[model samples]
Target chain A: MPTSFPPPTGDAEAEDTLSTLGEFGLIARLNAGRAQPAGTLLGPGDDAAVVAAPDERVVACTDVLVEGVHFRLDWSAPDQVGRKAAAANLADIAAMGAVPTALLVGLACSRDTPVETLTALVDGLWAEAGVVGVGVVGGDVAASPTLVLSVTALGTLEGRAPVTRAGARPGDVLAICGRVGWSAAGLAVLARGFRSPVAVVGAHRVPDPPYAAGPQAAKAGATSMIDISDGLIADLGHVARASGVLLDVRSRAFDVPARLVDVGAALGVDPLQWVLTGGEDHALAATFSGPLPEGWTEIGTVRAGDPAVLVDGRPYEGPPAGWDHFTR
Target chain B: MPTSFPPPTGDAEAEDTLSTLGEFGLIARLNAGRAQPAGTLLGPGDDAAVVAAPDERVVACTDVLVEGVHFRLDWSAPDQVGRKAAAANLADIAAMGAVPTALLVGLACSRDTPVETLTALVDGLWAEAGVVGVGVVGGDVAASPTLVLSVTALGTLEGRAPVTRAGARPGDVLAICGRVGWSAAGLAVLARGFRSPVAVVGAHRVPDPPYAAGPQAAKAGATSMIDISDGLIADLGHVARASGVLLDVRSRAFDVPARLVDVGAALGVDPLQWVLTGGEDHALAATFSGPLPEGWTEIGTVRAGDPAVLVDGRPYEGPPAGWDHFTR
Candidate 1:
């Protein structure tokens, strides 16, 4: 059913708040105009979705974003929030060497929220879902004081083995499949009101990861993999700890994206800090046993040593430690 | 590291709340003493978790619960919230006729939240996850003004076809696994502050569904199925609408538990209403083409007619309508 709050008219009395849209109305609006993938046996209308994991295995991950903590309403449009939420969760599925297939969203919003905001969030979710040929299979909605989103993504491996963070071994080549520090730069621009770097600020608001590179790396025999939710150094530390091997990252070899380099110059900030300590870039970092796949850039190596991450054979020194949800 | 604020110890300075706990302390407390299931290749300590889904197919579902709406903190313990969150998500997986494999939780809590509250919440999550033979895989923690939990459940089909809500056909038998209405009864007792005949209030706080029944139904070739999350008649209506068949439930044939009958008598509310319209029971309701497997009770039959649900071919009059997150 076309459940949605009527758009507000010039009359102040016609204000369309979330209470007017209600939970079901907002969901109905969200579900409208969405397309399901070919393999989705069941979609949003059911209690749960049945997806075809033909390869006999599935990759799954979840992430939660809270307004003010993860994003600000003044800085991020509802659409951007929706896209970022989906992006963050999907990155994890990709890190496991799988193709994302479906997503389930859990939303909590205040009754005073605008209908347009809710619709924008759904549109963003659908827009991103379409990019990966995935569907928003199901979700839960409830009332809260501020907006909150929890997204869970499910993916298919097409019979490939999962490339976990623990698979890195000494001598494995470390590589990356997307840009680094772009999101951190964007966040910096947003926080500092650097109007000249609007694009960077937007990137910080909504990250776009190279999803296909996950399976590509798997096909190329990636030994260990991780999505960069935390800064590169911090994330690599996870691989080091899990694999019981030392990871040495070569920052100088990272062919920094020209756009980010230009933005860093304009903002008068250290781009390396963004690359090494910025989080939410969602780039795929993995240790491969063979030649790197196309589009994959080799940046480091795994070594026989204590579980730790180092730069040029020593612990990397940067702008303090990377972000921690609680510490921050 | 322990992230959340420490619990209050009745010391004069024990008033430190979630805000004092901040983000990190809350995470540390919530994660304390939790163990991972054997199937988990990687657990909560990482950016994402890897779990076995050897059936080549997975069933996934998610749901979010909000404070002061889904549950009241003043009324329910933090542990209850945690259990209910996991239970509801796992129930959705069960409804898909799959065995739950893992869970990923997302939490947003107020800054004033006490570390002890978060610990209790995590303990509840573990307790419920243990019931379904799964473990908490991974999660995201953030700061918010209210307690919000978003849980996603992953399930394995074990080489069996997934039973969708659309597979019911004319002449199929409708059956139920496990007791229903106990949760509803518990809710009523809690709401009215009335004495309960059994531990029904506990059931309301933490539902214990027949977890194994879902996969068993899949193995036995159930045509259609769904969990009773939103009252029986309302949920069956979904199956009828999806499967294009009418479901005629024979109320007289219902094999309700003795505790419910006793509680209904003590509360002076009709036991049938609780059975028919009570939600959150998390019981599996399925339609089979033939005789049901052992331990299942036949409750109704599918017939060709308008897509509707009836008790003995007539409208089921009850005080409770189905449960809807948005509308309710």
Candidate 2:
């Protein structure tokens, strides 16, 4: 029984395009060598995938990445784009104090797209999911004028209560794990048409989200947590409003990386400003009343005031107010 | 505390574009007035949503619908398009013999898209989800050149084993639980630019999947199940190959509806061909070794032979070979 569509024949170059390979062929190619994790009871090929949700609950989130809006093919490889798309949603799951279990991708691209590009992009999705021992369980593909990746990640909380953005209290201390402003610096470098600073440019390409730190924070009794996708200040604003408390960050709390400092000097931009206002780093920010978890740096505190984010006791002045899809 | 983005003000007409309302505002509008089901532990407004997976396993799948590819705004209302998109993924869940729990949508569209259209589309998503007592728990929206809706549905098996496509035996009876080829008939009329025959046209716009019949068939000891999204013969091919048995459909078994026959006669086309090869009505086709479930009509028989779908024991001869996104 031949379950797959007929294999492509004739000239190899003509068969390289998605249109030549057809939808089923592309799907078969993308799923050819992928490995499923233990949590994946059933992987791709089925109508729906079944994944283990040991905690009796599933934490799920979706993040959509448009080609021009989120990344450029010239700046990042297809694999990198795939990784970033997966990271965005995986980080969201982690922000809820959950361990990611599976990812489902929905890709819409032009018929002229190269089959190689699609395969590499899926390879990146697999690589990132492999980081947490998860699998790309299922997805759908369609033909569109532009490339769009919509990734949905599912996770389990391991029996712990989810640490939401609305749990911060007046006396809680603010802490963060993972880098900030690196992606912003990377974007600035890319905007200047210089790709020499591989560090920041790579950061902009694929975020290294602290996935394990989420469960660690929850186990350590953190009250509130959020993924820093929209800069330190803008994302904290969400927490501030959600928790009904003012969050105040210290100016000197961050130890900006030397690479960013050197790049800031060369570019005539303040690295600290990027740390305070840049986004897309996918860092974890949480509030704790007890001792901070290892690897988390204390940077601010929650206070009794109007729901707002403050820098060094007052609102910080900045033009980079974080990424807003339509506004930008 | 203002958890929502600021309410729209100024001229109502000016505030109607997605650009004017912004991403957060549009999300708020889509989420406003919608009720969450009991299975939703955490709905939108956070990094992720938590849904109850009471059976310790979750069934998940993704389906993408493009504006021009899967639908046309002029042909179908935004809400109808939304309902169809949600129905596509929800039917996949039901086909797995699972009860739908939640949905996460990923929408990418031009910035100038109408706010009303987006809201209406979401309203349709909510309307369809409400039918099954589920919620649109979380999703993401982004700016793109075209509109694309990627919906991910999660479900629970409720202690029942999933009726997969590979479980059929040689002597199983093939049955169907819903209309087939009606959407194809509607599409034929729409392609010819005639909107009259409202019944078939409406079916093309929004599918009425027998959601309960999936679980009902599973409970009746059905060996295999599949959603007929690609067409009766084409989808049956999947079951035939997966089950390693030949599926032979009896042409006399189906009583083609008079509406399709009238339309087919008017168009000088065979209505039975549409019933055999037309897709997108989202009917359930399953193989049973035991007595058929209520509402199921036996249409074929599974036999020991090379894996293939046969119309009266021979290969189906037609041009409407089911829907394939890339090839078509």
Candidate 3:
């Protein structure tokens, strides 16, 4: 339905480029006929938007995605890029044990960018927000040499306390819900100029974050929670340091997906390495002292020791491991 | 005091670049020793930040600034750019009759960028947010070819209704608070490579938006409100269209400051034109049916007619007006 929307400004031929549609016209086109959730007090087209925060607090986070650095037009469609950008921030809010209320985006692109591309990107943003019953409440667009998207997600805790990284206690079980290594395998396939494995490639393009499992984990007595933006080992390193406990992941605990195993064999790399170190899956990773949530799988335990992450009781020994934006 | 903060890493010489400091290290440097406000329930280093929303609703907005598009490093210091970016979004919140509570920033830049530059920019963001007693709650950094800043501001309405741009009615008086055209004049001087006349040039670097006046105007029964980011006429055009009313500005209403007058005379242009059409001063424009609030100057009136902005009851005749990121 979004794709069927009319061209910006009604003059189909003249609305080819952003410059031709103009900034305000483009905004109107993007905002036209979108339905906001009940939490949206005021939607786009104003200086700011108002969203309900019934719990007396709002959870917020921001994530930046750059063209070529985060995604390439040749590898993923603009809509896919938009979905990935929104998911990155939305997952952060969910990791805080909150239900997303709204999203705000800031986009920078060249003047010559096609109007269709921009509209499709916004369509993706809307589609993702719709999945969680939220809306793209506000945003701004500007001209820049490289395309960049910065998204901020707001959510409500619904009266529960936030599950921070510092709360994990020794003896808590570490668990994860959602796909992990699929994105890394997808990235590998893309880099090698092969795209037949649509599952991995699609995983790389748009993550399927478990939106409800975050609050479900919190309600299930999660001591600490985090979203896997970096690889499992590296991100758990943060939890270990913050909670002042040792986190040990048992490699045998994982039941590797058959597709990833096949891809790994074809590429001559251990699939477990990708499972341990792959990032950007936006998977929900948390520690629980009580029973694991319905969708969660226990893979490790927290122990008393100096802060550090271990695989099978020792330092991980495969792949480059973890992502560092600047250094990488 | 912020300037006195030490280098990104303990080793001053080796930690000069972002690549050397690394993403986590750079984040640590930017967040080190900064005191978060009381409303910040959870600050940075978490998956998401939780901020107090006592009013049961949050007002939010986002704005983007690109390296060569919004500000130039050669023309403005990194700190100034940060302040400008923060101010741009903060003003939007204020225009909604809300008090800013927190800011979330997303930054993208080259790996070779100096750590000092990035930290200084964060200092400016802190400095600006500090003015309204808020904190930089959460953000992300990524690698890109050019520096791009995306700021999302959240605010509370304190149980008051948002004074949107659609409520203006016939016979309402239009008023303005804070400086206008000063930044435009400063831009003119900067374009000519004359950085002197510190007053105007400084205005270009950092806007002094009337933060308090927004709520004040609302309390005084403002019917409609907006902030002047684009030139007055251009921004008012939005209010006019949204409110479905004619807005007429009186030429003699403004008492142009002597500084701006002198600058205009020197540059061989009309200072009044700058006051009418210049932008980025972050001045508040509101319509009221009652008495004007403190610091507010009556400038025009709303009339019954089709949506349009008129200067002296006619179309504006002056230099190219307003800003469009792509077209201009």
B233-322, model 3: which lDDT tens digit per residue? 999999999999999999899999999999999999899988998889999999999999889999999999999989899989887778
lDDT of 3 by residue, A122-148 (tens): 888988898898999999988888999
RMSD of 3: 3.7
lDDT by candidate, in order shown: 0.82, 0.92, 0.91
- In candidate 2 chain A, where is summed lDDT lowest over 10 consecutive residues? A1-10
User: Among all windows of ten consecutive residues in candidate 1 chain A, which has the lowest summed lDDT?
Assistant: A1-10
The reply for model 2, stretches above 4 Å from the true place, is A1-15, B1-10
Arranged by TM-score, best first: 2, 3, 1
User: Considering TM-score, which of the candidate structures 1 and 2 is the better prediction for this target?
Assistant: 2
TM-score of each: 0.88, 0.97, 0.96
Q: Alpha-carbon error at B198 in model 2, in Å?
A: 1.0
Evaluated at residue B213, the lDDT of candidate 1 is 89
Cα deviation at A57, candidate 1, in Å, is 1.7
- Chain A TM-score compared with the true chain A, each model in order: 0.93, 0.96, 0.95
lDDT of 2 at A272: 93
For candidate 2, the TM-score is 0.97
The candidate scoring highest on lDDT is 2
